[model samples]
Target: MSAAPLTLTVATPLRVWFDAVEIVSLRAEDASGSFGIRPGHADCVTLLAPSVVRWTCTDGTTRYCAVDGGVLLVSRGVRISIACREAISGDSLESLEAGVRSRHAEEDDAARRARVEQLQLHARAVRQMLRYLRPHPGGGADGPDGPGIGANPR
Candidate 1:
């Protein structure tokens, strides 16, 4: 039996899009750690972190996206909606690399380092999410199996 397909959509401020052209990635915090969702996926919602989001198209093409933080919703029909602060797609690799380098440089400062660390942590979380969302890259959802809701219980 195959899993349902997931429709993933990423949205951010229009201004950001105008400034940086790219699409962000999404991931699910499943009981198996993290898993990527493409077009066909089960219906459920999960919490997301500040990390890079990765997605593999049906053609076997993989894309990486960076996000600060956001929420992931998986509908019964396998549709995903991601609401995040900011997202950078693979197309913006240069800009994203610059941003990462800039953040890394800030690590030299004590105060700034802390802030940068926090941001980096968020970015890492987002990356993890992207990895999770990568189709079949990781094993089946292996974190905390549940209904895929409130994984990040507020």
Candidate 2:
């Protein structure tokens, strides 16, 4: 007897990319490496990496969806759901791969820029604080040579 056909759904927070599509099998990757799911696979949850989810349709055509890290849930041995931050679906694997790579690179650049900005802001705040704490050079009560925090009492 043949295995039952599986239903696949790929969704993002803003939209559903694939909804209740009937597929013969599904393949995806996580930190643990690549894995496949059939109709009667065990129910479980896995954390997907920033990679492609490939599946075969009942008509023997293969499709792909690239995700930006998400969660995959298998339920009732027939339903497979993927919830990702972002998703890009395509019929051409080559184009899909290129698009995913470009998206990932853009995100990496943005994150790097944000971190640099944060560090600059932190450095600026520290400089301002140090300037406020430094003793004035004019040699008075609050000067570097007087009787205050940074001065030697004589």
Candidate 3:
């Protein structure tokens, strides 16, 4: 006898990847750990990790999706919805792995760029502060030795 079918939908920040797909089983990774979802399972919610979510289509074909992190909601153990920042679909495990690795590398590069920009902003702030606190060239009131900004009155 054929297995029962469950409807699946995966939504990301950009758009929806899956729309009412009929699947026989689902496998995913959450904070609690890896788990499986089958027809007639209890209704629940899971916080997905950066991993691949696999499922068996009604035709018995396996499919996969790469999710960085997100929430998966199951309603009545039949309708499943996933919300995430990023999600990509693949027809095979190898393709999913490649997609995930590429995305991970992109994120790392973006993070490095952000760190460099932050350091440059900090350097500019420090230079401006130094200019304001430095002694005036003419030893005027603004000088540190004078009775003005940053001056030491003894």
Candidate 4:
């Protein structure tokens, strides 16, 4: 008797990457290093790194995907599911590495820009709050006689 075929699924927060894949074996890399999986193997979980996950398809061809970082769960020694933030399919390993590096750099830049913008927003909000709390002499919004909550409106 032969081993059971794998039921593999790769998913992200947005959508499903691969719903079901039939494979005789799978090769994947994580923080520790690279490892392989065959059907009926021991069930375990891996903290995957930003690397490629490889497997041969049902059509007897190998496939690869670049994953940002995620969890690989091998359940019941038959099912494998990868939960990640992003997944990019690739035709080959070399091409996948190049594309993954480029995309990762772009993502890093975007994240840095977003953090800067968020900090700016927070700073602006704090300044506005301080202005309102300063208690101006005139009867304006920032004035002593203005609508400043908990302040003596003289």
Which prediction has more favorable lDDT, 2 or 3? 2
Model 3 per-residue lDDT tens digits across residues 1-154 = 7546899999987898999999999999998899999988899988999888999998899999988899999998788899999898999988888888888899999999999999999999999777667776555346344456745455
Model 1 ranges off by over 4 Å: 1-5, 15-33, 38-40, 91-96, 102-154
Candidate 1 lDDT tens digits, 1-154: 6454445667776523322122232444433467766444567676677777676544555556677767667665556677677766664557677776666566567687688889999999999876544434233432334322223333
- Using Cα atoms with residue i matched to residue i, what is each candidate's TM-score against the true structure? 0.46, 0.67, 0.76, 0.67
The per-prediction tally of clashing pairs is: 32, 0, 0, 0
Which prediction has the highest TM-score against the true structure? 3
Model 2: per-residue lDDT, tens digit, 1-154?
8988999999998999999999999999999999999989999999999888999999999999998899999999999999999999888899898887787799999999999999999999998767656766754235343355655455
Clash list (residue pairs), candidate 3? none
Ordering by lDDT: 2, 3, 4, 1
Model 1 per-residue lDDT at 152: 34
| TM-score between candidate 1 and the true structure | 0.46
Number of clashing residue pairs, candidate 3? 0
Give lDDT for model 3: 0.87
| Model 4: per-residue Cα lDDT at residue 47 | 90
Model 4, 80-112: lDDT tens per residue?
999999998877888888888888799899999
RMSD of 1: 24.9
- Stronger candidate by TM-score (1 vs 2): 2
> How far is 117's C-alpha from truth in model 2 (Å)?
12
